[model samples]
Target: MRKRVAVIGGGIAGLAAAVRLRDLTPPDTEIIVYEQSGALGGKLRTGELGGVTVERGAESFLMTGADGAESAAVALVKRLGLGDAIRHPARVPAALAFGGRLAPMPGGTLVGVPGDLAQLGDVAHADAERDHDAGRPLLAEGEDVAVGALVRERYGDEVVDRLVDPMLGGVYAGRADGLSLQVTMPQLARTARVEHTLRDAVRAAQRAGRRVPGKPIFGAVEGGMSRLVGAAAAASSARISLGLPVREIARTAHGWRLLLGPVPAPQTDDVDAVVLAVPASPAARLLSGVAPAAAAALGALDYASVALVGLALPPGTPLPDLSGFLVPPSEGTLVKAATFVTTKWSLPGDGPVIVRASLGRAGEQERLQFDDAVLLERAMSDLGALLGGELPPPVASWVQRWGGGLPQYAPGHLDRLAAARAALPPGLALAGAAFDGIGIPVCIASGERAAEDVSKAWEG
Candidate 1:
């Protein structure tokens, strides 16, 4: 029989790994993809409201480095004929909500840390200005520091409370302190790795001149991220079994065995190799018996629950003058950030504007419980203050919830990740946001690499 491989989880990591395995292995190699959920693409889902599209999960992908991994994402998108569906070539006027106003992120700021310190002090508060001049690096440059603490130290409390914390909170749907800087802002760590100052690293990136995707910006895909997920599913040759949750993974003499089926209807699939690509906590639960060490390491990582409140406004609705708003850690508001989706993307026609307000990160998950109607009311009320108008209620509304979606890459994350991968057995591999990166590109890379590692060992 041909070598058989089993991939658990249907998110980008598992899906990408399965497709790439088909690409690299012998034509008859057998691969099976199991997704507990009925659909694929994990968190990369999009919503439609009265002809408008809203991204409830990932908002955009930061393009960087033409590394083999990055190239794979581009190739996948291109293969799916999604080149035109990409909405942006780079980052746009992503602003910080400070003192109740939108402030354009400082020019040349990399991951909220200034690469050029000459103008950094100019935009900062009086106290933080002193810290930056003294080169205190208010944020920890190498080790993991609470994102809020680092921003406060470098730019003063105002920047952290108003801009940095809220902005990150929205993206991660978790508290800044609870989230690790290494996983979320590893780019800044490069400065610490090569030199002591992030300012120096920015200079280095500038000298290197556009390391990723032939562009040095961030972007969103067109027609929504959902289409990308569907396309990948369509291209796969693997036997995909959806809604089939695996209860346990066990080691077998010939290969490995999966104890699957919801209680009262259990079945099994024994394959030559296995890939655990679910969220960290759940992955840990499934792997406790086969690889105790891998399970322990995965379970150690923190995850956050998050919710998105999407609103569909009528055509010609006037928006508050603010371009977009972020919630700093100090805001004491349930809302972490709000996106002006219409301004951020191109509309097909003059239709209703789509807006997304993010709520609940970690400790704030309870706030997501105000009930849907009440939740929308609260979101809009808070939005009104920032938008400054009695806009009509949304023509449509969608509420989506993700439990333990984004992984909190606390400080020393890379070290821990290396430790986890090192502990896995030779024929076994790990993938998904639980490892190196959480974005679609990062997860896809993890999947491809895992397949390569396993394939190399199997062939030998």
Candidate 2:
């Protein structure tokens, strides 16, 4: 009998799993991908605004090193022969909306944690005595802390609210105070536990020659992140079914069976192994009966909502040449961050300058409830303030809402995942942003790991 593997979900994680299964499994082994929606990429949406391709979901992936070659995302792109399509952002540093002025981001910082307080010009500093003193540890051994709390404790509220919040907003769309240091920023977390000061810790680490030098920190596909999804789907020989929602998963005589389609007319597929690569909520519901403990843990996970509003400014509109700016929550503005798409990426057509604003967060869903027009107005208002003047109306605009899109990585997330895995059935695996990470590369890695686990179980 031919072995069969069913991958539930068509997002990056699921696609990565299916691709790996096709590559690793025998010729007779069958691989199938089931996507609930018409589209394959979950949050990797790309579309045209003013005849130019622009990203609505995730836009880029962080390189593993300065070299940009070792990341799983890059490797996947190369494997799919998309190496030429890779694009790097212009060498421009982002600015922070500080005190109603655009301020350059201080050098020597790790995700908003300042390695040299001297670089931060009056953005709040730690007590000189405590900062220089030894024996004072930011974290005790084995102690997990929130990223926000740790940064605030060491540098003060100004640093966390200004530097960290904007960076966190760009990625998680959730508050830093609610995210785990160990899970969200593991390297910093490890360093924080032993070091007395962030500056000293950064210096010591750099001196130890642990950091990769002269590597591109981030990269994206030429068209958009959606290109990566398209390439992944086309590369694999796996059977794909779109708009087929998996309603149930049950253990069968030989393996697992998935109930698909609407309730009135359901279809079923029996496979030797299964991978649950959807978000936490749906994955929890799927595992409720089979893995009760895992379901409980997954159900406890929370998510954040956000809206990306794209605006096409009239040509020759006066604007800063920088990439973008991050608005700290302390600014009490509707806009969280802005990405100057035209400045960062290569657009296809000679369209108006493109800029996108991200609004809302885990607890700030009310702003997302506003109508598209209202959201556009609010984003423009913030942009005008940051740009130092009022601007003309947009020639083109696009609004994309992602409700419950980003999963919150609260403290102790790792422990919760461990518990969930302990309760999963044999020949079954879970992979998605809600697990270990929420980025493109991390999700790909998660899917690959799940495929490896299932393959090993089948072989053993």
Candidate 3:
């Protein structure tokens, strides 16, 4: 019998799932991808600013995973024949905007948690005495805690607010107080399970994650992130159904049926297996009847909205030699992070100095409700303040807003997701940023895992 798989949500995760299904199943297996939006690559959109290719969504991904192996994203790029297009950032240090001045980010820190307490120079004060052994491990087996709560308990408020929060905000658009250690810093969390002190745990985690010397930590496609999305989609060879919403999914004796399109006139798709790769809310809605527990867990997840402001300053505009800087929420600025795109990447024939600023943090939705012009103004203002000089008006500018774009992985997020996955029925699996941790590599691995799960169910 010819097998068929339906992949809901045509983002990177869904497309990656489709590609994996194609690789695993027989050549005759049919894979179809349905995307609610008119486009693919949910948070990997790329745009042109002043004739320069720039990413409107995620700009880059970690080059290697914690084990010092090539990241899943790099592996996918190789599989898709885009290995040559990989571009590493220039070896410029990042800074933290503190008290209206840029301070070099401290060294030997795991996501802003100083592995060596003595290395935390000027960025933030750590209470070294409080980091002494408590005669027990920092975390109990299978227990989860917020990254901020754990750090604050040992290092004090300065460490969490000044160092950790901004670093986390740059990636998750979430505060450290709310994000889960297991979900965000799994390596550190694992070490904390056995290590008696927070500093010791950080040291152990850092030692475990020691990468190859002189290798760049981050990478991006030469063209843009869109190239990655396009390659993955083409390689998947799945029937593309754009701008259609999958209304409901119901299990059938033979397999599964999906109710898609509008309620007035719907379409049905029957498949041997299905991959739910959408965001938490919609995934919850579709799974409510079939997997109530999973639905409830999915519904409990929260998201953060953010806007990216890209500017193309005239060539010869003086900017810092650094790649970028992150701003602590205590700085009271609309801009949380900014990247010097052209300075960071070796773009060919760059006509203008490209800069991208990220605005808005978790639980600050109202601050991002402004129009593009207003948001751009606020971002430019913040940049000027950070740079300590008024920047010249850009020759070209762009603003991209992503509402609920980032998932806030609360404490126990991984446990909740595990239980949700366990409760799901056979022939159905979930993938994407919501189920797994965020980031391109994580999402890609998640999609591939879902593909494997459904393939096994079909084989059975």
Candidate 4:
């Protein structure tokens, strides 16, 4: 009999896993991907704006490679015949809203951690004094610490709120104080344990030749992220069932049994292997019967909700020449960050200038409760300050809300992941932003790794 493999989610991670499974397993192996939503590409969604397709979720992904090597994501895109469709961002620096005015981000900073204390100037807190005693070791031996608390102790509160909060918010949609330093920025965390100060550690790394010159760091699909989703689905050849959420799972004599669809009238599938590529909460709920310990750990994880508002302004509106600006949490604004969509990517057709505004963070979901029109108004208010004046009534507008979008990596996240993975069954694997890194490429890699894990078990 042909082997059957089941993928619980149809997001990038699940799709990538299904594709990898197809390649690793025999030709007759049957692979199926079940997605609860009507559409694929969980966060890689795109929408029409100004007659052009623009990304509603993640716009671009950071590339990873050593010098001349191609990143996994780049290789995948090229393999899918999308090599020519890759577009790099226009050269522009992002500005920081500080002291009631826009200021250029300080040079020699890594995710808001300043490499040189002298560079901070007015950005550092006025009463902030560098803690020379950071070398005394506040964290327990071999323990993780919050990124914001560590920075605040070494640098100051202003540095954490002004520089670190905005940069971390742009990535996790969570506050820096709640995020793990080791998980978010691994290299810095390692150096912090040995070096007396962040500045010293950064200097040491620079001396050790850690800089890469003239290398592009980010890439996006020419049309939209939706193209990547379509290509992955085609490449995998896995049966995709949309709007069919898997409700339950049970151990079977052959391998496993999945109960899918609504509770009243459900569908069942028996599979030799299963890959869970869904969010932490859903995965936890599904695993309760089989892996209670893993389920409990997953249930402990927290998520941050965010909203993206896309606006098309009249042509020739005087906007900042830069890519976009980030609002410091101290600014007391609903909008956290704004991206100049047209400036950052090549849209399908030019109808009007497109701008994407991001609102809400982990603890700031109160503003997201408002209606779309009200949210648009709040976004416009922030954009007005960014552009130094009120923007013209948007020719087109869209609001895409992602509830529990980003998983918060609180301190000890790595340890928790290890425990959860140890508790999972032999042929059952988990993947997604909840376990590994949160970037697009990382999520893809996580799914591929999960597929590889299940393949080994099946072979044994």
lDDT of 2 by residue, 1-460 (tens): 6899999999999999988888889988989999999989999988877667888889888766323346788888888899998888887778888888888877777777777778877655554444554677667777777888866766677778888888788788878899998777776667666778766765654444354666667889887888889889987788899999998899987789899999999999999999999999999999988899999998988999999999888866656777888878888888888988887774433568899899987799987898998999999998898888997898889999999999999988888999999999889999989897987888988999999999999898
TM-score (all chains, Cα) for each model: 0.89, 0.95, 0.99, 0.95
Question: Each candidate: what lDDT?
Answer: 0.71, 0.84, 0.93, 0.84
Regions more than 4 Å wrong, model 1? 66-71, 89-92, 116-156, 197-216, 320-323
Residue runs of model 4 more than 4 Å from their true location after superposition: 65-69, 126-129, 133-141, 204-211, 346-350
Model 4, poorest ten-residue lDDT window? 126-135
Clash pairs for candidate 3: none
Clashes of each: 13, 2, 0, 0
For residues 248-355, what per-residue lDDT tens digits would candidate 1 score against the true structure?
988888788899988898999988888788888878898788778767877888777777788888887876434366766555656677877776665643788778
| Runs in model 2 lying further than 4 Å from the true structure | 65-69, 132-137, 202-213, 346-350
Tell me how candidate 3 scores on lDDT: 0.93
Better of 1 and 3 by TM-score: 3
- Model 3 quality (TM-score): 0.99
Q: What's the lDDT for residue 327 in model 3?
A: 94
